[model samples]
Target: MTKKIYWAAVIYTILGLLGGLYYRELTKAKNFTGETQLAILHTHLLALGTLVFLIVLVLEKVFALSETKSFKPFFWSYHAGMVITVGGMAVHGTLTVLGKESGGAIAGIAGLGHIILTVAFVLLFAGLYARISDKQPVKAA
Candidate 1:
């Protein structure tokens, strides 16, 4: 489980790097213009997704998070949120760059993604709280 979390963080980091390179290339080509929606996507993928996952990995050992029933749900929900949010950002950014305005649907999808992210965080916190509250002191060998 810990390995899975680490791998997920690594994947997000690689993707974030790719997004940065792509954004730099687009800027060099004068295609990026002033629309920073994709830029936000790039940063958030690294900052929120990658960084947060890494933090959770560190927390897992301290909290024994694997023992919690909510661990699986938290993991899946958070990753799904990242995918939906980043996917929305990509679509919305592409449309903006193409000079096409994002309609209500696009905005709504993105909004839903954020909502999922919020719920996922809530679940994660609850799981952590449960583990911490129930934790027992370790005995010396």
Candidate 2:
């Protein structure tokens, strides 16, 4: 699980760097000087994907979090949410750069991603709390 989480972080870091490169090159090609969602995709992937996975890796070391019941659900949910969120942003940004108007559906889909992430966070905390509370206290003889 630690290796898996670490690999996830590495993958996300590479993706984030690619995203940034895409944004720069695309904007340059389009001569787009204004703001676009592409600008944030890089940061979002880095922060939410890479950094969050690293934190989880540490937590797993401390708590053996992967053994918890909710860990699997949280992991899947987090990845699903991240993919949906990043996909939406990429599409929306591309449309914006191309001077195309997008409807509310895209925004709603991206919001759904956020909602999933929120639920995943709750699951992680619940698991962490369970781990902490299950620990027996040291005796003071």
Candidate 3:
């Protein structure tokens, strides 16, 4: 599980770098007015997705978090939320750049993604709390 999380972080980092490059080039061309939104998507994907997974790796090691019951759900929900949220942003940004308006459906999907992210975080925190509370006190060396 820790390995999977680390790999996910690596993948998201690569994706974020690519997205940054894409945004730079697109903005340079002045063909995509919605490049800013794509940039936001890129940041969120790297920060929330990549950074969060890295944190999870640390938690797994420090707290043995992956052994908790909540780990699996937290992992799946968070990744799914990231994908949906970033995908919605990409679609919406593309449409905007094309001078097209996005309907309520796109916004709804993004909203749902955020909601899932929130739930996942709650689960993660709950698991962390459980592990922390269960920890034994450190003894002097």
Candidate 4:
């Protein structure tokens, strides 16, 4: 799971860099809206894709998943959400580049995916809080 998160982070970072470079070139060509969408793409990749994935990865290591089974579901949920969210952003971003405002199948799916991603973030937060706040009886030495 840690490996998966790291790989996702690396991939997302690379894509974000590419998007940035593309935005730079577009800006040089005076393509304003293209630059704006590319900026959004960069943020989406870095924040939702890289940052959230890293947080989950560190939490997995810190929490010791081998000792806890329940966390698996939350971790999977967050990861899945990030995947779908990033995938949607990629499709929608590309479409936006083509001068399409909205009203397409991919656009609809992308919008739904963003909502799922937000829900996933909330679930992850709840799971972490629950895990940390649970009390375990202590044995006195």
Candidate 5:
């Protein structure tokens, strides 16, 4: 997870910067709808790609659940969700570049992917939190 987050941070940073530039171009072209939608996608990608992944990595390290049953599932799900979400966002971005008003399939897929990825991350976080905090010390130091 730590390694995953490190890579994600690098990729996300690049993606975010490029997305920002695209957004500026959209604004300059007076394409408000495209700008807004792509902005949402960009923000989502940036947040999940960097912040959320890092948080998960920290949680994994702090909990020391390398061999735990939930660890593998959590890791795989998060990454899989990321792939789908990112791919969908890319599709949407391409379509946006082509000047599509409705956004076609990309919009629907991106929306769905975002929802799924959000849920996957939440579940992963919850599982890690539960495993770590479920047992409390009977006595404090």
Candidate 6:
């Protein structure tokens, strides 16, 4: 599990770097000057993907989070949410760069992604809390 978490962090970092490069080159190629959703892809991937996973790795080392059943569900759901969210960003950003108007579907999809991410957070925290509770040593009254 630790290895998996470490590798996940590494992959996310690479993806974040690639996202930045893609955004820069894409906008430059099109000479886009104004703000677009693409501008945020890099930060989102780095902060949410790379940074979050790195932090999770540390927490796993200390708490052995994967030992909890909730960890598996949280892991899969988090990845699904990220894929949906980042995919929405890429689509919306591309359409923006191309001067195409996206109606409301993109926003809806992104919202769903955020909802899933929120659920995943709850799962993680629940599992962490449970683990901590089990580890607590009662003091003599």
lDDT of each: 0.81, 0.90, 0.81, 0.63, 0.64, 0.86
Candidate 5 RMSD to the correct structure: 4.6
Give the per-residue lDDT digits (tens) of candidate 1, residues 17-99.
Answer: 88777667766576556865777878989998799989999988677676677778889988888888888888887777666
lDDT of 6 by residue, 1-141 (tens): 899888888888888898889889988999988778888988888898889999999888788888887899998899989888988998899889888997799989988999999999999998888778985322233
CA deviation > 4 Å runs, candidate 6 = 135-141
Off by over 4 Å in 2: 135-141
Give the 10-residue window scoring lowest on summed lDDT in candidate 6.
Answer: 132-141
- The segments of candidate 5 whose C-alpha lies over 4 angstroms from its true place after superposition are 26-35, 93-97, 102-104, 133-141
Look at candidate 4 and tell me the lDDT of residue 53: 70
Worst 10 residues of 5 by lDDT: 132-141
| TM-scores vs. true structure, each candidate | 0.89, 0.93, 0.88, 0.67, 0.67, 0.93
lDDT of 5 at 109: 71
Question: Model 5 Cα displacement at 110 (Å)?
Answer: 1.6
Residue 6 displacement (Å), model 2: 0.9
Which ten residues in a row are the worst by lDDT in model 3? 132-141
Candidate 5 per-residue lDDT, tens place, 82-112, comes to 7777677656665665666544576677667
Clashing pairs in 2: none
Q: Any runs in candidate 1 off by more than 4 Å, and if so which? A: 135-141
Summarize candidate 4's per-residue lDDT along 1-141 as a digit string, tens digits.
678767878877887787677666655565655433455777777777778677777876775432344455655665666566666666665556656664577666766777766766666666666567763212232
| lDDT string, candidate 2, 5-118, tens digits | 999999999999999999999999999988889999999999999999999999988888888888899999999999999989988998898899878999999999999999
Error of 6 at 99 (Å): 0.5
Please report the candidate that would top TM-score against the real structure.
2
